[model samples]
Target: MENNSKKIIHKGISASSGKFYGKCLKILSGEHLILQIHISEDEVHHEIEKFENTIYLTKQELESTIQKFSKELKKELVEILSSQILMLEDPIFLQNVKERIQKKLENAPLAVHNTIEEIAERLSSLGDGYLSERAVDIRDIGERIEANLVGKRSDYTFLENLKEEVILVAHVLTPSQIIHLDKNKVKAIATDTGGKTGHMAILAKNYNIPAVVGLIDITEKISEDEYIFIDADEGIIIQNPSLNEIKLFGASSKTDFGDSKFKPKKIAETRDGTRILVKANLESESDCDLALKYGADGIGLYRSESLFLEHPSNNPTEDEQFHAYKKIVEGMKNKPVIIRTFDLGADKFENEKEENPFLGKRGIRYCLQNKNWFKKQLRAILRASVYGELSLMLPMVTSIQEIIETKELLKESKDLLKSANVPYKRVKIGIMVETPAVAISPDVFTKECDFFSIGTNDLLQYTVAVDRNNSVISDLYNPYHISFFRLLVNTIQIAKKQNIPVGICGEIASDTNFTILLIGLGLREFSVSLPLVPKVKKIIQVIEISQAKKLAKEIMKLSEEEKYLEIESYLFNKHLLNNLV
Candidate 1:
């Protein structure tokens, strides 16, 4: 294609939104071609020298520009560019590619591109999108190397003076690229490649942009400056849209999607006066904003696993852990945040070894065995609570004694914090009702712990003796089982009898049907994903608690074989109102 005839309309996940018109700077596929090396040993040595020189130049150029941005951006840019450069200099990869090219007697650029393409295709076929994207990065590196091998330099350019009212399209997007997008200027984003979990998908969600992904070869169909319409609801992209479609989508798109400024009302009373507590699950400090925006009554479950995942190691220092906790609490101010301690069991931790990890070392069991690691997490929670309303919970507690011992450990850590002159709030402690042992013995656990949070996900798995992670038996692990709901209600019933609060911070809480069931079952507090709160809250507002309770009673009496489909149809047919954000 001639440069004059080249048109620019790359499809991508719209990280930011708007509509505008600009001239094209089409980035063709062959620009950064990496050649395969098939020369003699002396030539191979010389090629390595060239690769080193190119890497050094790229590093120096990046370093000189580092100070122009904030620390996070600088760090990310360095990490991304550095990784690409390092891959080029990897002796193993370089040697392997060189040998393959020599054996094939092919053009170096063609050979390298083919190998990268082949590997990418294989990974893509494996069915994991995350793993497939890694292949794209490899191909990108090869392109950069190919450019160098042919005496070409990287001509990557940033889009400047972007139109303020333009819809951006691309094949895909990255977290780093999304961060740089001017959200105020862009209208919507559409991509040819991505899924709901991809970084671009998450960013588009947070930015309140209309985004559609996984459309094949859409870049070729879209024309530069052509009026287009994006409907995120149906995952539809209409190029040169008809006037009727534009009017409909434009009206829907105008609704406010950003985080609400006010904290979510804890008193989630419907117009008819049914009350429910809308709590939020915390994954990290970053999740706090989403929680507050959604008007969460409090933080229900804080997964400490994300902190460890962010760092390069399995364990973070107590102080570092405290800082992460403190950030979330400080964000909430006086609102309560329930922090769950290190949940790393043999299965969750990459470095750890355990036989039948789920049944082996997980939750409270793992904490007890790794006393020092457990204490550090407890100490961090204690220190952070000094700043705001805070509470702690132990996950995967199977026995009454485990809860008792964990409570004792909490006391020990609290005493240490007190001795150090840290002013702290009196924290309410709880245990996750996960295994059937605790569910059946709720009377014992309720008496020992301050509160309970039914971890429905794991409880369902344990109830059916099915591994939730195993796809083969996924159908068997049903949360809707009459017995499962019975256990949950029984546990909540125990908490109510004991006058100790029981909250649900599981995926089930987010489902509208289950929300009603829980309310009817005498469970008053619910902690759900931030995005689902409005809909759940709205449902609570309209639902009659007595009706739900009556339905729960009916469900409890039905046999397992008769309940699943009956309940599904009943709920689906009810036209149960849901507030989707």
Candidate 2:
């Protein structure tokens, strides 16, 4: 029953950037659900044995492959799968499922499926939008098992049939799916659902996949083998694209994307030949190597949250934290690495098991309460500082008092290390001006801190009162708001007045269109995703800092809409002239 369906095109979020042309190789898709079926105690034991055996076999078989790719792109892929395997022994998870299944009297798979159904129903029942969204995590674990059973391993070469270059269309993608994809054969990816922070998007960005996500019902409308054009710049996916549209897109793609060297090669430079600093934002130590390989001037934001993510404990030890930070610093050598202290809290790290964890325990509030955690990280950074170029950046600080307190903590950690006969180095401490209070009161912070890094991602969310993860208020999370510019201007002026440096490490700095706007706002240092350095650097190379400053002043006076429109017009005009000379 081989029915040839006409090729259809669907739209999704373009997490990665590049043109991919290939035959459709779609995988089965399903909604997120954690189901636990009824199973006898005996059956549960047998299934557990089977799961262990399967993991053992998989590990033995994949050991050589994992070792071969260690520290490379495949390293993270292997680590993620290994963590999933560890879940089989997770006492709480296994025991909870066992009890639920015993009451239902079903097999392991059925019991898991039933529990998923129950959890899904409960989530649906919850009227609290904040709590209801966490059901996705439950479903993710189940998906991992299903993926393992279905033989869709993410080793890149698994899909032998997908050898020709083409775009991948899917309902949704898991981390493994994106990790295992063969970029040589696959040109781009478009998924029907996934947030900007989802693993699929993150994986795509890491691998340089031309991805588009957050496209609703795109899979249902688009057919297999359809001629589709994904315009990532405009967030548009065109099905049955006209020849003219393809040509126009093709031209744009040629300029911005094409071939194996998809990322921009030019470094950010000033028209007068001054080199503007370009650094990469890092989530984990593994990402540090990638940043250096991409020619980042240094690291602007080394997010410390990754240290806490995979662990069961509330905080990682100072020794453990020190090793990770040390590795990143050692990897970067002479490059300046700005490490942002643990910044999780808010809605970003929601655990269903922990009631009201966001408002209850997170960020500095959580650390201040758990001084052991705070001191460990501070001590580790101090120790790592002696080994390489290091600077500390505090996250979510609302007042000068917070900055002062954090500085005292650093001094205390340094003193403790000094007393212990452990080597330590004097490191510059900085604060992230994210909240309105901090942005407005930058002068007070400048007096206490070594530098200021404006985290526009959180700033935009707080300014608009938008839960960026929520679809309802997502539109309001505009980075181009004139009010945002005013905040930047204020932060910059205050920092400059105190003879300190200011850098932007938000998504805005990475955007080529707004590179000039950032420079014009008096931001001399820019930090972005690793892959974006060359493009941002190229933009820096073309624009004169003085001209950018003039444009920034003009934009600040315009209406928010007009301000954004003017910036676009300016970039477009530059684009026409190929003025990035």
Candidate 3:
């Protein structure tokens, strides 16, 4: 890793935390050239068999990976990789490729690649016509199966067999690509393409690796085995650093509570003795223990749709939903748990197509349209409510009419349970304040819902009119934009005026400096990815409310042009921990 060159720095989006020094390990990606080959009628049957067998092999690999890394990976990531196995077993998917090989006399690789390309294109047609989350999954799965058919080493296996500890760089890396990585040897990651909300970023955070993406041309810039320093905390990279710079950085990394979750975990409180609610956004019951381990104040978002999605048919029975909800509620032992009802749409679930799935029927709108399915989930949640403090949260709610209708359904659910002589409890209801309609008229919503959780993921997208997944314009989807902050302040103030509780449940990873900014804006609760509980707590424990308020006021006063100039200085400053206040 030793080098003799001028020091250079590059900036990118910070996808994970902690800094490290290692030799560069560049992973080059190239298109897998599948030459189309025609064959005789007799060879067509053989091609179909080969295609089926290759899928079986790929399925076995995915299963083994699931069993092997189940502990290290978080529940959501495990689900993502598990989705690949489902793809391999899909009867229609298998039939489609077999049809191509048999009818067109195509080779197994060519048939498989063509079917995948078609499906990927079809998936991209959903929700703004970009590469949706599911499209990426399909494409990654295709790469795996195609590689298996051609007798090539899979991406994870090649990367897993590395001989030395190093920083990995690639044109791009999918969550599927990093499934079998050797965490011990792969010290950090740098990539040429990715965004904060992409699956890779979520996985990188779960695995606790230092990662920076969206460098655009970093793969071409960095050479193999070169010494480089990754300041992932600030999304900065330094190449061929002097020994003096290395020593200074190395010393700080060691003492930064470098190992383990923060020991002596207790209630999170700020410097001025104000308590902060650090909640975990739970999607699966398996993560309940992990949340408790990290001293989570409560469950901020129990995405009940995950349970529905987990079912092979994408519809779990009432008992199935009840048990899962009950388990998470009981595990928390009386701590508040907020469960969001099914948030599925055409883009996410198997259903009739829409011109714009994200803007069309989704969340409460979908549930309302299908009342029977909606009531079943409501009854299950009502049943689980008695086990502990559980709340029902409606997602994508833009109007008070949705709340009124949902209440009527809740009453029907209770009546059904009452007729059956089943026991249940009435729980507080909440709404995810993500839509611009709600933000535009915040006061109207405060009187209806018990509380609000600002879902910044969708809010930022709906308000900014840019999809964060689209790399071409994702740069413009800024949380620090003056318009975004104005809307945020408006929502927070309206909720405060009505004496309603409010907090944020998304967009923490996009900007590390925004934690205090949120608190300064009067947000008291933080329901984040479970892995970030300790990091959030550390920030909350250091700063006082007064200082955060002052910073918020100053930032709000800046013009759009002046705001970026001033915020960039604070954003790029690497030593904020020591001088946070």
* Each model's total of backbone clashes: 30, 42, 0
Q: CA lDDT, every prediction?
A: 0.65, 0.66, 0.79
Q: What's the TM for model 2?
A: 0.63
- Per-residue lDDT, model 1, residue 459, is 89
lDDT of 1 by residue, 116-174 (tens): 67767887888766666566556556665566557675443342245556666666555
Give the Cα RMSD of candidate 1: 13.0
Write down the worst ten-residue block by lDDT for model 2: 249-258
Provide the global lDDT of candidate 2 against the true structure.
0.66
Best by lDDT: 3
The residue-level lDDT of candidate 3 at 149 comes to 91
Which residue runs does candidate 2 get wrong by more than 4 Å?
A: 1-25, 29-206, 210-267, 346-361, 560-567, 571-581
Could you tell me the lDDT of residue 371 within candidate 1? 77
Arrange candidates by lDDT, descending. Answer: 3, 2, 1
Give candidate 1 regions above 4 Å deviation: 1-172, 175-205, 208-267, 349-352, 559-561, 576-581
Tens-digit per-residue lDDT, 125-160, candidate 3: 765212554676788899888888989876666777
Candidate with better TM-score, 1 vs 2: 2
Per-residue lDDT of model 2, residues 373-395, tens digit only: 68889999989998789999888
Greater-TM-score candidate between 2 and 3: 2
